[model samples]
Target: MSVKTKLRAPSTVLVLLALCLLVSVFAISGGEYQMTPWQVLKVLFGQGEGIENMVIWQWRMPRAVAALLFGAALALSGAVFQSLTRNPLGSPDIIGFSTGAYTGALITLTVLGGGFVATSLGALTGGLLTALLVYLLAWRNGTAGFRLILVGIGISSVLASFNHFLVLRAELDVAMAAAVWGAGTLNGLTWQSVTPVGILVVLVSALLLANSSQLRMLQLGDDLCRALGMRVERTKLLLVVLAVFLVAAVTSLAGPIAFVALVAPQIARRLAGSAGLQLVPTALVGALLLASSDLLAQRLFAPVQLPVGVVTVCFGGLYLIYLLNRRTTKV
Candidate 1:
């Protein structure tokens, strides 16, 4: 059975990877200035000439890479939180991480000016602090899944209201900037923007991989995991920290791009069919979802490019409603 499971998942992952690559190539080849697949290949490998090379290499490729990294990071973070809390609904956006990051970035953009590093640092601080606050508030004799989720929802509402209030109070330019960032655009993503996010995803993904076994143990409940020689509390802390950092980094880079984290893991688990959590597959699925959403954002409306977050939010919200119905029927 284990062997069959192993064989099946690799094949599925391979197929998903193939789809991701194919879709990415199509995404790269698109835009106001279209490039052929071969032109894209040539430009990527530094063998193309003049404008074609410049268009493919300088613009489209970086955006595509950004989508991939952002999607992967969102998916991984969602998967980690889902595993840690044992809740399918667990996600950065739902738990206030996105709101926290948004509030932080908004404060920086409005109060301190649009210094990139300052904004990013502020986002990180906000995300981590919010997560810590949620955890502390949720703590009891045992931190049950329901308690954490309730606390998260409560905190999310407060942070969201605060964020809106701040935006409302800001100057027009600052408020508009904050609103755009909150909408989550990947506009103007150069290679420089892509590189750091790519690196952060890789590093955080490695940490998640290292903690995978412990995460599995965590699903068995704290006392059970303790009996099984797992340091449940420590594992939970590490996973939350890693999850917060992953979401924080991406949110800082791209402004809490909505629904990717919430939707990706659920989709991946459906693909894998049964589930506690599946990391690699979720990440791949996320890359596919975000890349495809970005493609739609660019091409669907044409000249008036909608933010990728808007697209995902619409789709993911519908999907969430469906899940809720299913859960109710099952109950």
Candidate 2:
């Protein structure tokens, strides 16, 4: 890589990181009980007193951090899937993994009466199983990206229906809880809730980054990648598994916040002008998107909060329609 390009990646990442910080501070500053950016910073640094400290540290800070972490995880997961499948549409949300994770959480909440731990396990189980099924069904002579995407879409539709059924069949209170969770809000998130997933995101993201070299090779097509001495199938499988873990981790914590994964990587790629996937930039974009959305969700209605997922769905749904229309026109 040229020195300019090398410098550009870090510089772009720095800009994104700065934006994420700015948005997070903005998010923390706004709410039912608003604070100035200066107050938020003071509270963050242990200088604020009483309610200011409680609001910023105990409540708003954790939620903002969760939003940032979840966004980064989803974005990185999307980038990995897109790279593996070579399809812009190949996201966990589009491919049924998110639906599957939702189903798992529903079962935990409704049937097992489990708490966050149970729900997290269930979500991970559901997402991994769905991915496996999609991969197996898509397998022919080999797994084609288009075929895998189609199979995932089909499975996702079915799982989505099942998820709806689960919600409906659940008892009233349980159903209500599941419905809210399905909508994907970051409300009431404490440090306890954020810690485990935060750790997982950090670890899994590091693994993905370490494998970034091999991942870029796979984007060049299997034959060429294999010619370069990469074990194409093994690498793809590992990457997909890691991607599944990342998606499940976020879904379990945030309840399938949509379209950050689907949109962030594309945004990052466009910003960086990178031919291959830009993982770090994508993660930053994801963080910024989710944190900003959460902030909007909190203050948009002022006392009455909307789910962050609702905002994402609004934007993501339009983007999906546009992508389909563009693809149709091209075809």
Per TM-score, the best of the predicted structures is 2
Q: Best candidate, lDDT-wise?
A: 2
Question: Model 2, 1-331: lDDT tens per residue?
Answer: 8888778878999899998988888888987787899888888787999989887888888898899989999999999988888989988898888888888878888888999899999999998999899989999968899899999999999999988988898899999988998999898889998999899989999999999988888988999987988888888889999998998998888898999999998889988867777888999999999988898898889888899999999988998999889899999
Alpha-carbon lDDT, every model: 0.84, 0.89
Candidate 2 accuracy as TM-score: 0.96
For every model shown, the clashing-pair count is: 0, 0
List candidate 1 segments past 4 Å from native. 2-4
Per-residue C-alpha lDDT of model 1 across residues 14-102, encoded as one tens digit per residue: 98899888888888888788778877777767788899877877887788888888898899998887777777788888888878877
Clash number for model 2?
Answer: 0
Give TM-scores for every candidate, taking all chains together and pairing residue i with residue i.
0.95, 0.96
lDDT, candidate 1, residue 157? 96
Let me know the TM-score candidate 1 reaches against the reference structure. 0.95
